[model samples]
Target: MAMEASEIESLIRTGIPDAHVEITDLAGDGNHYAARVVAESFRGLPRVQQQRRVYEALGGRMGGVLHALQLTTAVPE
Candidate 1:
């Protein structure tokens, strides 16, 4: 089954409490998503680590139920 956008947002928020998360359904399919996450915690982290943090927030669902995610992370300006 495809994961809901709300579920993805909730997971990210739960993991990164201060994050500002925006999720988009790229293909109009529940399985594909594009997420833009902004967090103060990401300020000093490298891009890879920032992405990893978001992935970790998904709790191992990345290649399973969550299929594909186009993710972007940034620190608050």
Candidate 2:
């Protein structure tokens, strides 16, 4: 099963209400995606932790239904 881009965005927003999330289907396939997430909550967090937050929002679909993701995270400017 492949995950939809909207689902990804929805999950991120659900997990981090204050986040600004952008999701792209890199391979034109729902299984592969790239997401850029910006949030005030990410401030002072390590890169790994920021990325972890996004991954957690996905509800453990990273290596199953979602397949692969190229993720970028940052604090709001």
Candidate 3:
């Protein structure tokens, strides 16, 4: 099963409500995706921790519906 970009965005939004998210289909197929997320929730966290939070938001969908995700996470300026 492939995961659509919107699905990924939805999961992210569920975790961080006020997030600015951008999703791209890296391989044209929905299997591979890249997401850039900006949110205030990341302010008190480290970069790796921020990314882990996003990964956790996927809720074990990473290897199933979503094959791979290239993620960039950050706090808003």
Q: Name the top lDDT candidate.
A: 1
The candidate scoring highest on TM-score is 1
Q: Rank the candidates by TM-score, best first.
A: 1, 2, 3
Residue-wise C-alpha lDDT for candidate 1, range 1-77, written one tens digit per residue: 99999999999999999999999999998999999999999998999999999999999999999999999999999
- Every candidate's CA RMSD: 0.5, 0.6, 0.8
How high is each candidate's TM-score? 0.98, 0.96, 0.94
Q: Model 2: runs farther than 4 Å from truth? A: none
Give all candidates' CA lDDT scores: 0.97, 0.93, 0.90
Is candidate 2 or 3 superior in lDDT? 2
Worst 10 residues of 3 by lDDT: 57-66
lDDT of 1: 0.97
The Cα RMSD in angstroms, rounded to one decimal, for candidate 1 relative to the true structure is 0.5
Residue 35 C-alpha lDDT in model 3: 97
> Once all C-alphas are superposed, what RMSD does model 3 give against the true structure?
0.8
Please give the range of 10 consecutive residues that has the lowest summed lDDT in model 2. 53-62
